[model samples]
Target chain A: MVLHIMADALFISVAILTIGSAIVALETRELVYGAIGLAISMMGIAGFFLLLDSPFVAMFQITVYVGAVAVLVIFTVMLVRTQALFSIKEDPRRKTAGIVLLLVFIGGIGAVVLASGLGNPAFTKFNKPAIDVATIGKQMVTYYAPVLVLLGLTLAASVIGALALARREDIEQKNERVD
Target chain B: MATVPEEFRFGNFLASIIWVILIVIVLLTLVILPLTFIVLFYVPLPPVNGEVLTPYLFLTMIVDPTRTLPIVKYLIHTTPFKVIVFPGFVFAAIIAAATIFVERKFLAKMQLRVGPLYAGVWGVGEGILQLAADGLKVISKEILIPSGADKPIFWAAPIAFVATAAAVVALIPVAPGWVVSNTDVGLIAVFAILGFFPLIALLFSWASNSKYPFIGGLRALHQMIAFEIPFILSALSVVILAGSLNLTHIATSQHPFWFILFLPISAFVFFISSLAELERVPFDLPEAESEIVAGWLTETSGMIYGLIQLGSYLKVYALAALFVILFLGGWSGPQIFPHQLGPPDAIPLVKVLTLQGLYNAVTVNAIFWFLVKTIVIIMLMLLPRGISPRIRIDILLHTGWYKLIVLAFVNMFVALALIYAGVLGPGGSLSIH
Candidate 1:
C-alpha cells in the first residue's frame, strides 16, 4: 500500500515536472534557458513513460528528447547571433495570460485526479508483449506494410526532388560566374 | 558558511538516494530478465527431436519451472536500493575502463607500436588504474558553467544522457529470460530512445553558446532527419520478415535460419543505419573535432566528457547487441553437445552457460566479441568519416535523399521478392501463372 502510494506520488511529481518544464521550454525568454527547460521537460516525459509501464519508451524519451531535441534547440540558439538575443521580442500580456491559463488548467487536472483515483480498467491482456519491432513489421507488411512502402516511395521522390532543386541553384550560380 | 537549512539538506540527500534506488531497480530488471529463461531451463535429460534446433530444445529440456520466478522476483524486489547501485555503477565503469585499455593498446598495435607499456602491470592496467584516478580527478575539478550558458541545462544534460543509455540495457536480454521489463514495444522503445541522442548532443552544443558547436548541432539535426528514415524503415524489414515485434519472439523466429540469411540486404541496411544512428566515424559530423572543435561537446570537461564518451560507446554496444539478436542468431550457437543428456532449459546451468558463456563472460562479452563487432562497424563508419573526406552540405543532403533512400527502397523490394521466392522460408513460392 505504501509502495503504491509512493509510486503514484513519484509519477505525479515527474508528470508535473515534465509538463511544467515543457511550458517553460516553450515560453522562456532566453533561448538557452528555453533549451535547458526543454531538456528538463523531456526528462519529465521520460519519467511519465516509466509510470506508463514502458521503460523502453522512457529511455527513448530521455535519449531522443533530452539527448537529441534539447541539443538541437541549444545548437540553434548558438547559431543565431547573440545580438539577435537582444532584438528578440517578449510579449508580457500573452505571457501573463499563458501562465494564468496554465495554472487553471493544472488545477483542474489535479481536481479531476482527486475526484477519481487511478483505478485499473481491465483490458484484454496480450499473450506476449506487442508492438515489438518484428510485430510492427508483420502488421505493416501483412496489413499496413503497403502504407510503409508508399511512405518510402514518397520519401525517395522528395529526396530526389530536393537534390534537383538544390542542383538547379548550383547551375544558376555557375552560369552567373561564367557570364 | 553553508546557509541552507538542515531540513533542506536532509530532503535533498533523501531525494538523491531515492533517485539512485529507482535507477538501480530499472537497471536490474532490464539486465536480468533474459537470464531468467536460461536459469529456468537448467534441469534434466535432453529430448530427441531431430527437427528442433538443439540449443533451444536443449534449453527447454533443462528448464526447471521451479527456479524461474525466484531469482527474477528477487532481483525485481531488491533492485530499488543503494546496494545494487554500487555494483551496477562499478560494472559500467569497469567496462568503460577495459574499453579504454583495449582501445589504447589496439590503436597502438594498429599503428605498429607498443601502447601504454610503462603503466601499472606494464600497461595491463594501463588506463585501468586511471579509471579511479580519472574519477577522482573529475570530481575534484571545478564544474565550469560557461558564459551565456544555462547552468541548470549544462549540469543536468550529462546525468540525463548517461542515465537513459544505462536504462536501455534493461530491455536488452543478456541470456534467455534475462531482461528487465519485456514490453511489446521494445523495438519502438529502442528506436525512440536512440532518436534522442543527437538532439541531446545538439542541446549540449547550444548550451555552450559557441560557434562551432552551433554548426555541429545544425549538421547533426539535418543528418538525424536524413538518417532516421532509412534506419527506422530497415528495422521494419526485420519486423516484416519476423511477423512479430517482441524481441524474444524475434529471436525465436530465427531458430530455423538467422533472418540475415534470408534477407541479407535488410540486415545490411539495418547495420549501416545503426552505424549512422550511433554517430560514429563517417556519420559523426555532430562532433567532428578537427572541424568543429569537438562540436556539441566543445566546452564539456572532466567527468561530463567521460559520460559522453561512455554513452557513445554503450550506444555502439547496444546497436551491435541488437544486430546479434535481430539478424545474427542471439544466444543461438551451433550445438556440439548431445541432446540425449538433458532437457533444453533443464540442461545444467554450466552446459547452457557454456553455449552462452562467451556472450556473458565478462571480458569476452563486454570487451572482445562486443568490441570486435562494434569496432568493425565503427571502422566501416570511419572509412567514410575522413577517408572519403567531407562533402558539401548539399552533397550530404543529396546522397541521403537520393542515393541511400532509393537504395533502401530497392533493398525492401529485394527482401520482399526474396521472401516471395521461397528464399526466406518453405511456405512462400513465387508462382508465375
Candidate 2:
C-alpha cells in the first residue's frame, strides 16, 4: 500500500516536472535555455517510461532524444547569432493560432484516450510482466525486420542527404579553385 | 585595506569551541532527539532474527555487543548499504581516488619525475596521502564564479557530472550480485547514462559564457557524440556474443574463455572509443590546457574543478571496469582464496570479527580479480597520456566516425560468424551452459 502511494507520488511529480520543463522550453527567451528545458522535459518523459515499467524504452528515450537531439539543438542554438537567441518577436495572431492549436491537440488527445478505454481500471492495470529486450530483439528480427530495415534505410539516407547539404558550399569553393 | 587583524588567542578559541559544542548539545537534545523519536515511532521496523525490532530493542542491541551481529548483518543487506558503501559510491570514489594518485605517479615516472613526494608518512609511501591533502585543500578553497555566468547551472553542473558518473558506477558489477542497480538492459543503461556527460559539458561551458569554454564545449559535444556510435557498436558485438544485455550475465558468459580471444578488434575499438569518450590523452581536446585554457572547465575553481576531476576519474574507473567485464572475463581467475579463512569450528567471536556471515571466499576472489584487471586497464589508459600528444579535433572526429566504427563493425561480423559456426552461444561447442 505504501509502495503504491509512493509510486503515485513519483508519477505525479514526474508529470509535473515534464510539463513544467516543456512550458519553460516554449516560454524561455534564451534559445540555449529552451534547449536545456527541452532536454529536461524529455528526461521527464523517460521517467514516465520508467514508471510504465519499460526501462529499455526509457533508456532509449534518454539516449536518442535528450542525449543526441537536444544536444544538437543546443549546439546549433549556440552557433547562431547571440542577439537572435533572446529575441522572439511576438504577434497577436501567432499567439491566438498557437492557443487554438494547443487546445485542438489537447482535445484530440483527450478524445483518443476516451475512445481507447484507457481510462478504465481494467485497461490501466498491468498484470503481465514487462517484455524483455531479448524478446523484443527476436520480434524485431522475425516479424518487424522489413520495417526495421526500412527505418534504418531512411535514417541512413537522411544522414547522407544532410552531409551532402552541408558539404555543398565546400564543393562549390573547390570548383571555383579548380576554375 | 592592508590592515593586520588582531593576533590569535588560544583562550578565545577554546571559549568559541565550547560555545559551539554547547549549542550542538542543546540542538541534539531539543530538536534532533525529538525529531528522531517522532520519525521512528511512525516508521516500520524490520524483523531481526525472527523477532520484531522495536526502538527499545534497537537501543538494547546498540548497548549489547553480543546482539549487534544480526543488526549489522541486516544493515549490510539494506539498499542504502549497497548504494552507499559496497559496489556503489564509496567503492567507486575510492577507486577514482586511487586512479588519480596512480595516474599522477605513473605519468610522473613516464615523464622522468618524482610525483607527490611530500604527502605520505615520512615519504615512506612516496605520496599515498596526496589525494587526502588535495581533497582538503580543494574543499577549503573558495569557489569562484564569473560575474555574468549563469549562477544555477554553474553551481549545479559539477554536482550533475558526479551524480551521472555515480549512476553509471551503480550499473557496473564488481562481483556477481554486487551491482547496485542490476537492470536487465545494463549495457544500454550505461550508454544512456554516458550520454549525459556531453550535455553537462556544454551546459557548463555555456554557463561560463567565455570564448575558450564555448569552443571547448563544442569540441566535447562533437567528440563524445562522434565516438558514441563506435562505443555502442563495439559493445553490441559483445552483446551479440553473450546474447544477453545484463552486464553480470555477459561477464559470467565468458567463463570458458574471455571475449577478447574472439573479438580482439572489438576490444581494441572499445578501448579507443572509451578513451575518446573519457577525453583522455590523445583525445583530451576538450581540455587541451595549452590551446583552450582547460576547455569547458576554464571557469571552474576550487571544489568545482575538483568535482569535475573526480567525475572524470570515476568515469575512467567505470569504463575500464566495463572493458574488463566485457573482454577480460570479469572476476574469472584461479581459485586463490581458500574455502574458509580458518577452521570451521572457530569461536563465534573470531567468526564475527572476520565477518564470516558477509564474507564468501568466492566473492572475495571475484572482487580481487576484478579490481586487478580494472587497475591494469586503467594503467594502460594512463600510459597514452605520457607518450602521445592530443590529436587535432578534425582527426579525432574522423577517427571516431570512420576508423573505430569500421573496426567495431568488422568485429560484429566476426561475432556473428562465431555464433553461426557453433563456436559459442546456446548449445554450441564451447558453450559453458
Candidate 3:
C-alpha cells in the first residue's frame, strides 16, 4: 500500500513539474530562462519514461533533448548577443484564435482518453515485462529496418547540406569596392 | 535610527513580540498542520520490525544494538546508503581526491620539480595534505559575483555541475549487485548524463556575462559535441562484442579474454575521446589559462571554482570506472576468494557485526579486481596531463570530428567480422556465458 501511494505521488509530482515547465517555457520573456524551462520539461518527460519502465528511452531522452537539443538552443540564443529580450504584443483576435485552438486540442485529447479507456491496468498488461535493450535492437533491425535506413540517409543529406551552406560565399574582386 | 531606539522602548518591543508570536501560531496551525496531513495521507507508513516505525521509535532503535542490526541492514540496502556512502558520491569523491594528490606528486617527479612542498601546517607529512589545505583556503576566500552577472544562474551553475556528475556516478556498478541505481540501460544512462556537462558549462559562462567566457563557452560546446559521436561509436563496438547494453553483463562477458585485445582500435578511440571530453592536457583549449585567462572559468571565484573542480574530478573517476567495466574484464580474475569464511553459524558476533553471509566469495573478489582496474585506468588518464601540451582548438575539433569517428568505425567493422567468423559471441567456442 505504501509503495502504491508513493508511486501515485511520484506520478503526480512529475506531471506537475512537466506542465509547469512547459508553461514557463512558453510564457517566459528571457530566452535563456525559457531554454532552461525546456530542459526541465525534458527531464520531467524522462521521469515519466522511468515510471513507464522504459529506462533506455528515459536516458536517451535526457541525453538527446536536455543535453544536445537544449544546449544547441541556448548556444544560438547566446550567439545573438543580448541579455534581455523584448516580446511584441499580439492582437486580441490572434489571442482569441490561439485560445480556441488550445481548447479544441484539449477537448480532443479528453475525448480520446475517454474512448480508449486508458489507465485500466488490466487493459495494458499484456506482456507485463520490461523490454530489454537487445530485443529493442533486434526489433529495430528486423521490423523497422527501412525506417532506420531512411533516417540515416536523411541525416547524411542534412550534414552535406549544412556543409554546403556553411561554405564561404565568393564574389568577384572587380565587383567589390575597396574600403 | 537614534530617534527610533529612543522612542522604541518596551512598548514597541512587546508589540513586535506579540505580532511575531501571533504569526508563528497562525502559520503552524493553519499551514504546517494541513501540509503534514496531506503528506501523511498520500504516503503510507513503512513497517519496521512488525511495527509502523514511528518517528519516536527511530531513536530507540539506535540504542538497543541487537534490535538495531536488522534495521541497520535494512538501511544499508536503501537508496541513501547507496547514494551517499558505498559506490556513490563519497566513494567517488575520495577517489577523486586521491587522484589529485597522486597526479601532483607523480607529475612533480616526471618534471624534476618539487610539487606542493609546504601546503598545510609547517609542511608536515611532506605536503601529502595539500588538497585539504587548498580546499580550506578556497573555502575561506570570498565568492565574488560580477555586477552585471545573472545572479541566479551564476549561483546555481556550479552546484548543478556537481549534481550532474553525482547523478552519472549513481549509474555505475562497483561490484555485482552492489550498484546504486541498477537498470537495463546503465551505459546509455551514463552517456545521457554526460550530455549535461556541456550545457552546464555554457550556462555558467553565459551567466558570467563576459567576453572571454563567451568565447570559452563556444569552444567547450564545440569540443564536447564533436567528441560525443566518437565516444558513442567506440562504446557501440563494445556493446556489439558483448551483445549486451547492461554494464554488469558486459563486464561478466569478458571473463578470460579482455575486450581490449580484440577491439584495440575501439579502445584507442575511446581513450582519445575521453581525454577530449574531460578537457585534459592535450585537449583543454576551453580552459587554457595562458591564452584565455582560464577560459569559461575565469570569473568563478572561491568555493564556486572548488565545486567545478570537484565535479570534473568526479567525472574523471566515473569515466575511469566505465573504461574498467567495459574493457578491463571487471571483477574477473583467478579463483582465489574463499567460498565461506568459516562454518555456518559458528560465530554469532561475526554474523551480527560483519554480516558474514552477505559477503559472498565472488562479490569480494569482484570488488577487488574492479578497484584494481579502475585505479590503473585513472593513472593512465593522469599521465597525459604531465606529458602532452594543449593542442589548438581547430586541430582538436578536426581530429574529434573526422579521425576519431573513422577509427571507431573501423573497429566496429572488425568486431562485426569477428562475430561473423564465429571467433566469439553467442554460441561460439570462446563465449564466456
Model 2: residues with Cα > 4 Å off, grouped in runs: A82-97, A169-179, B1-42
Tens-digit lDDT string for candidate 1 (B145-182): 67988676677778867766765655555445545546
Better candidate by lDDT, 2 or 3: 2
Q: Provide C-alpha RMSD values for all models, in order.
A: 12.7, 3.5, 7.3
Candidate structures ordered by lDDT, highest first: 2, 3, 1
State the interface C-alpha RMSD of candidate 3: 0.8
Clashes of each: 65, 0, 0
Tens digit per residue, CA lDDT, model 1, A125-170 = 3345423344444677788978999999999999999988777677
CA lDDT, every prediction?
A: 0.64, 0.92, 0.87
- Give the per-residue lDDT of model 2 (tens digit) for B7-32: 77788889999999999999999999
**Candidate 1, superposed: residue stretches over 4 Å from native:** A1-7, A35-179, B1-93, B122-143, B335-397, B421-433
TM-score of each model, in listed order: 0.65, 0.92, 0.85
Model 1, position B116, has a per-residue lDDT of 64
User: B218-246, model 3: which lDDT tens digit per residue?
Assistant: 88999999999999999999999899888
Candidate 1 scores an iRMS of: 4.5
Question: Candidates sorted by DockQ, descending order?
Answer: 2, 3, 1
Count of backbone collisions in candidate 2: 0
